[model samples]
Target chain A: MSAMAARSPFRTDGTWLLVGPAVIFLMLFFIYPFGYGFWLSFNPAEGAWSANYQKFFSDEHLWRTLIVTFQLSLPVTILNVGLALPIAFQLRRKTRYQRWVTTLLVIPITLGTVLIAEGMLTYFGPRGWLSQFLQLLHIYDGPIRLTHNFTGVVLSLVISGFPFAFLLTLSYVTGIDPTLARAAATLGAGPWDQFRHIYLPLLAPGLAITFCLAFVQAFSVFPSAVLVGAPSGPTRVISLAAYEAAFEQYDYSMASAVAMIMGFAQLIVVVAVLGLRRGLYRGPVGGGKG
Target chain B: MSAPSERRHWFYSVWSGLLLGLMAFFILNIGLMVAAVVTNSFGRRWLGTWLPEGYTTQWYAAAWKEFQLGDVLWVTAEVVLVVVALSIIIGVPAAYALARRQFRGKQLVMLLFILPLIIPPITYGIPMATVMYQAHLGGTLSGVILSNLVPALPFVILVMTPFIEQIDPTLESAARVFGANTLRIFWHVLIPLLMPGILAASLLVLVRTIAMFELTFLTAGPDSQTLVVALYYAVFAAGVRAPQSVDAMAMVYMAATLVWLLIALRFVNPTQLVSRVKEQPAH
Candidate 1:
């Protein structure tokens, strides 16, 4: 800390002033609420500290929702990252087509969840296009059930999350020094070898960060779940459950407890990610342009 | 070698073709979705076809009349503007300190600011709403605005830090040498250099705020509902046969966001902004 003081002209007072606003803002809105929420988790209404947690664990529906949340998130993360890698690699060609591909990829970020669900209802619903197409081909006797189930929710999550993962990985891939790859080629290395030794190592940190980001995005999913996800099936994510508790039942204390548990789970996961990759923060992948 | 070069050319063409095909598929999907909403808004009926049967603007009229769509739009705009402005105001100075100065627990502070981003909104929304309720701020516009600050503040800080760090500190020192005080130096030298970053941050914040549904939905009551929240209620609540109205409202929301995105892309490079935080290597 003192080392930083020597380089900058700002005195201690001035630096504190500069950083104070952001800290206070985060503390008031983020940390305090988080702390209060955690406290509530321990002290449920009309019970001991562990009582609420015990109830949560005992409830089959709560456990089911948690499992569903994980089921939806894990598959979406894996699928999104898996699918995005090839598109990202191909886009590194830096051709005109690559530019168009990138632009098109950003289109989904603007579409809100409500619109996405509405579109799914019309396009993939029982009487929607897919069902009609299948029926016309004599592949099915009745309408195909795509909505109101796990299939619809997973599809929606994949569609919304794929672009985000793709964009993140694409940027990382392009940032790699092509010179390194060329040098590997000149050294009698093949494409796979070049990728394994040079590209993979550089991409490791980016991949980890992108996975965490994509996972969190999928985990916090609500709109798509409620809109397309069947409440009875394995699609009632923890977020949806928490929302119902807080608003529908007006059980603020219980809702806070649920939220706190989710937050803590996320924090632990992030800590694990950071711990697994020690040298991720070493250098900027893409050097800042002056 | 010549054969390999030819092979590479063939590979490139095939790969490019596939990539473009996927991109076009994605674009077409979004286009179809928008077209459906727009067609539905226009009172067009489509039973079992890709396109609609007929077209009219009566749904939009009905949606407007029934939902007080204009007021919802106003609330969204007002909240987004206030959130963006407040985030920039607080975030810029803090970003400068983080980038330029060394502080104890700096890493911890950075992590703390970024925590909101990692934790899903649902994780925070519940507790935050409870705290608001206790404070009697729940269901108020101010509560919604404050909850938004949780995410928006970190975003502004993360985006602006690199931009501020890029400005050579000597320039500010030079200004000070010319008898300009700290305040003056910041006002004239730093502000001008950071303007583009500020604009880019504002645009990002604006888009985020507009699309924000979960937090607002949880905290806002009927009077404070945003357009997205209103649309959510319209669809899920029982005895509400207003799918057409929902489609119409969604189209309006989509149009507003699309316009903002176009404007953002025109002024700020989306790639640059998205990658700003990742571009900063942790020390």
Candidate 2:
């Protein structure tokens, strides 16, 4: 295969040129904007180069957005990954129902967060079906205050984030050779033992990556944060702050600062997860020790 | 396989049952939420009821007129199609290279492509929009397209790489042996083999671009808003518009996504929905 690939005129000749456009495009669009934003964050309007950073750190109101965002993202990420891990493990083997379940889950994912927020507003509202159903069943009497609060944002995140977490987790879970589990079983391992001794070690690295991916998605909770969250109160996430800074205040420098801070916060979590993943098994994933 | 003893069987059944119950509850909640939106959109008065007081299509009409659905849909179609076409045009060849060639700094190049996928858009979008504004492209259709391509382009590369890797390079060599040049081998041989992948990437990008909110939201002006962004405005805009009308607009947005989603699902495995991009290594 390697020889064929090398002999093929397509690969040996100016195949490198084929990569040029994408590299140039990403450099122009993705990298340039990132560097530009970093630089712009320092050059604020009406003060020193550190003005935006100084203002952000000094203001309890501004920096508090970080904690609020973490509060929302952390629990949501943990919950999505936590619930998805076992379910994906159980469904790792092919089943007739897996397709239907995945298809159903894809509905919320494709529908996107904006529609979910809209649905949550009406469905979780005081007069919505959930409240009505709860009342009818005498489960609770008062209006369920799920919308326009911290809980609302969390619920919206799970609704959208869980399917994503599940799909990714399922892909990782299924990628493991099933014969590994069968081999473990033959060694008199129970389900829990198989999971703990066999699957978990192999899965540790993938789960860490999954956690980071899900964390990044949860961290940037914008549309749902605004539509379902109280944009001014407890649910005032950092992205919302950045949006306000850019569009409402027309301070691109302040917005850039907030965005940079957001990126920095997310990077901390990703790096930590990846660092931990390095200490895991990291052996052959296809069912061999060597 | 041997039959499990009663105790082990019992334990397994109970555990599976509990997980199934949880999944069922989640699916039910989602179903109800969507039903609530659809019901309210056609409802006369839905206050505290299992169903609406009466059904009518007036809200859809009202939403269409009030939200200017025609223009927003046109913009969304234009943006999504162009992004899909441009990303594929710019991405497939790169994927082919990454698949077939081993080179210096290839790992760095792979990392560059993956960065845009794992990083949250809003974090980068703010600065990207700032750059776009300075370039005099922000608030224009071109700005929206460029911002979205930041993610869509890389996604195309990541997805197509694996698909391209799977095709036997011997075929390309055979085409080369026949004196077909690189471009012809790609055009006549590789493309026909890659149709499934291209279709999958295009349709998934189509659905995603329509649903993509942050980049579009950050750079879009009133004229450039896509359907999802427009739906956000309808919900977020300070106004006295009826809830039903907004729900109606939400339904319109939902219908657009659902149609493409169902079609995309036929071509795309649900497990591949996220494109398995992170784990692929440059060989």
Give each model's whole-structure lDDT. Answer: 0.76, 0.88
Write model 1 residue lDDT over A176-229, tens digit each, in one string: 767777777777666556667777777878788888888888888888888787
| Best candidate according to lDDT | 2
Best by TM-score: 2
Model 2 spans with C-alpha error above 4 angstroms:
A1-12, A280-290, B1-9, B277-283
lDDT of 2 by residue, A14-86 (tens): 7668888999999998999889889889889889999999999899889899999999999999999999999
- C-alpha lDDT of candidate 2 relative to the true structure: 0.88
RMSD (CA, angstroms), candidate 2:
3.2
Residue pairs whose backbone atoms clash in candidate 1: B42-B56
RMSD of each: 3.7, 3.2
| Candidate 2 per-residue C-alpha lDDT over B97-119 given as tens digits, one digit per residue, 9 for 90 to 100 | 89988765677889999999989
Native-to-model Cα distance after best TM-score fit, residue B26 in candidate 2, in Å: 0.4
